[model samples]
Target: MTRRTVRIAMNGVTGRMGYRQHLVRSLLALREQGGLDLGDGTTLWPEPVLVGRREHALRAIAERHGIEQWSTDLAAVLADPSVEIYFDAQVTSAREEAVRQAIAAGKHIYCEKPTGTTTVGALELARLATAAGVKHGVVQDKLFLPGLLKLRRLVEGGFFGRILSVRGEFGYWVFEGDWQSAQRPSWNYRSEDGGGIAADMFPHWEYVMHELFGPVRTVQALTATHIPQRWDEQGKPYDATADDAAYGIFELEGGIVAQINSSWAVRVDRDELVEFQVDGTQGSAVAGLRKCRAQHRSATPKPVWNPDLPATERFRDQWQEVPDNGDFDNGFKAQWELFLRHVALDEPWRWDLLAGARGVQLAELGLKSSAQGRRLEVPELSL
Candidate 1:
């Protein structure tokens, strides 16, 4: 079989998600597996050139990963004729311009969600990519999770006769950095640094709701900064201007209502860090990050609400656990493989820059809803 190489200029490798998920788990793992089989007598090998702002950090990552090329010069990487793809996992605020540059350089572009800080910027990037005729994609990793996949299967199989509503609970307590070190970066709590629960999480919720149920028609949100102060990685006190928690109500097409709560200040009591409960006329299903359970109408136990009697129904045991009949790859890796195929073979890809722009639109509208203290309509994007 003929082997082909796709040179990728990967920016922002020093960040946590960029380093761990994209580079180490996905790209490196794929390389270790002897590259991707194109199914056309050729294999596409991923050759990543790590790009970052710090030379020491880039050198360290290269040394640890056994990478041959590491450079702090992003312009040089973009200018290199051998580079076919430019992937960005940078902060949300810095994505648009870098992606624009990559598209201008005639490279396929892929990046993380909330493509830009504003919906306009995100849409502009999409327009530019389309004008440049570059293959562009954004990370929508939640749709590929094991639990969500099972839920999708249930939906596709018509397990829910008439889908009614969805309730999503997501979050875990983040240390305030007073007595304990903060688990998240200090920038996450500062609005000036493109940090906020709504901005970071609303895009994920938007895509999930849109894909699982339908497009969002309207949204009502309330956001708050529960912890106002925190210490940084340098052990210095700083004010947290951005919100840490957000409670939102999204009205989807077909009259499906979804209530999602995202936060960094709440304690988790669910089966997983993130879970979604969907109730339908025929049955109900609850899906977490890795597991899904369903209770059909026929098997659901009848319960009478009475204050006079002690409850002994054992509600949690009634649901049947969904089995993983096939191997489930990491969400990031799965998307990465798909993007590679889309680029190499001109395969159909639905998760393009425009879809990513919709995510950004939802987040921006959510913030507006919270600020205005009312439900607001979500307009569809045209470009």
Candidate 2:
């Protein structure tokens, strides 16, 4: 097999998600596995050119990973003729401009979302990539998770006969930077920094609903800044201007209602930090990051509500666990492989910029719905 190398200019490796998921687990993991087999007579190897503002962090990552290239200048990296792909995992406020610059430099785009701070900006990025005729994709990694994959399998196999509703619980208590350091960055709680639960998580929910159930038709939301003040990375107090929690009700096609509550203030009670329970006439399933359990109509327990009696039914034990028939990969890595193939061989890809734009649109409308105190229609987007 012929070996081919594709240079990928990766930005924002200093961030937690970018460092852990994209750089280490995904790309470096692939490198360790001898790159990707293209199913042709060719093996595609990814050569990463780490791009970031911090020279110390970038250099440390490069040296630690045995990477040859690390740059503080994004322009010079983008201008390099050998760099075929541009990957972004930067903050929301900085992503649009950087991505625009990358697209203009004729590189294939693969980045994290919300693709832009606003729907309009996201759409513009999509249009620019389309017009430039570049292979572009967004990181919708949750769709590839083991639990969601099993859920999708059930959906495809008609396990859910006439699906009723979906209830999603996602979040964990992020510590304030006082006694204990905050888990997330301080920017996440600042509106000026493009931070909010609605903007950050609604995009994931949008694609999950759109792909598994149906397209979202309408949305109703209530947003709140539960914590008004939080300490920053330097242990200094700052006003939290963004909404840390969001409760959303989404109406999907085929009369499916999805209610998801996203919060950074709530403590986790579920099996996973994020989980979705889908109900239907035939069966019901609860899926988390790696586990899925289903209770069919035949096996579902019957419970009676009583004022004086203590609960005796083991509701959690009633559901059967979904077995993993095959080996599962890291979701971020899986999508990275697909995107690499799409760029290399023009593989059939669906998770493009437009799909990302739809996610951003949902977030935009969701925030609007909260502000207006009403349900807002999600119109179909184009171009």
What's the distance in Å from true for residue 375, model 1? Answer: 0.6
Q: Which residue segments of model 2 deviate by more than 4 Å?
A: none
* Alpha-carbon deviation at 41 in model 2, angstroms: 1.8
Candidate 2 lDDT for residue 218:
97
Report every candidate's CA lDDT.
0.93, 0.96
> What tens-digit string does per-residue lDDT give for candidate 1 at 133-153?
999999999999999999999
- lDDT for each residue of candidate 2 in 116-200, tens digit (9 for 90 to 100): 9889999999999999999999999999999999999999999989999999999999998999999999999999999998999
Best by lDDT: 2
Give the Å shift of residue 174 in candidate 2: 0.1
Give candidates' CA RMSD values in order.
0.8, 0.7
Scored against the true structure, residue 196 in model 2 reaches a CA lDDT of 92
In model 2, which residue pairs have backbone atoms overlapping below 3 Å? none
